[model samples]
Target chain A: MQVNKSDLLRRLKKIEGQVRGVQKMIEEDRYCMDILVQLAAIKSATHNIGLAILEGHTKRCVSNAIRSGDGEQAINEMMEVLRSFVK
Target chain B: MQVNKSDLLRRLKKIEGQVRGVQKMIEEDRYCMDILVQLAAIKSATHNIGLAILEGHTKRCVSNAIRSGDGEQAINEMMEVLRSFVK
Candidate 1:
């Protein structure tokens, strides 16, 4: 499964807007809790995006490697991605 | 700064082993809390990996883009990565 680059871009643009909004909120001295809420939303959005990419990668790259009798390599790649993701 | 693919691969190999260990723990009927603790460790490890990549990307890709007067593009790329990450 190929990653939908354009769709991902669109989502990212929106997220960027949200980030900027948060920045603005901070500049304007928004309540701490309110800012935290937005921050949480941004975090959740980011995590969702990660999950999507992970899903796609698993379906396409990892699955192909396994099918090709290179399961170790695929798992290695996945682990690499996950490592980066968690960091 | 280019990403250190070899180093990343090595780290990932370790994480892969951890994941497999977790699986084995499950199969062996390990305590749920113990398994969860391992899971948490894995999650933290994964997040650390992500942080490293993000740091590298920011110091290299994003900073370069800004220095070259392509800040918008860099930010957009960052947002895309963030989107994927949060999901």
Candidate 2:
């Protein structure tokens, strides 16, 4: 979690623009397959953001928790969030 | 877009299990990079679910809106959701 918060937000903002672009493409009657391609790219970008967050969490929260002997609780909380994300 | 809802839910449930497994690996003090690799897998799984939803929305909602001459508004609504997802 020692990463620059603003950097992460900036990356998210870029993805926001891409999402808007995809919406516009859909509205403009773009080809179905083309739209799916754009959606795939957006999904990949989203996964990158998620990966960044996971890296931060593992490096900071998980490491700290393990050192403090609270790793189980921390992992449980992470599992909860992950389950929610998948849902 | 015509995909079975139950199938999607089933896939998500499996991903939920994978997420929990990753958490368990973390609690056992697995290597940092190994945890990141597991996280990467989870993120990819999540992206797959997102792709399915996006496909459904485009084929059903967007296509219907286009035929009904409400495509612009529908796209705007979709943009809102995309914004939230990136956030």
i-RMS, every candidate? 15.4, 10.7
Report fnat, model 2: 0.05
- Clash tally, candidates in order: 23, 0
Query: Looking at candidate 2, what is the lDDT of residue B63?
Result: 87
Candidate 2: where is the Cα deviation over 4 Å?
Answer: A1-87, B1-3, B83-87
DockQ of 1: 0.03
Name the docking class for model 2: incorrect
C-alpha lDDT (0 to 100) for residue A55 of candidate 1: 56
| Candidate 1 chain B lDDT trough over 10 residues, lowest sum | B58-67
The candidate that wins on lDDT is: 1
What does the lDDT read for residue A22 in candidate 1? Answer: 95
True contacts kept of 1: 0.00
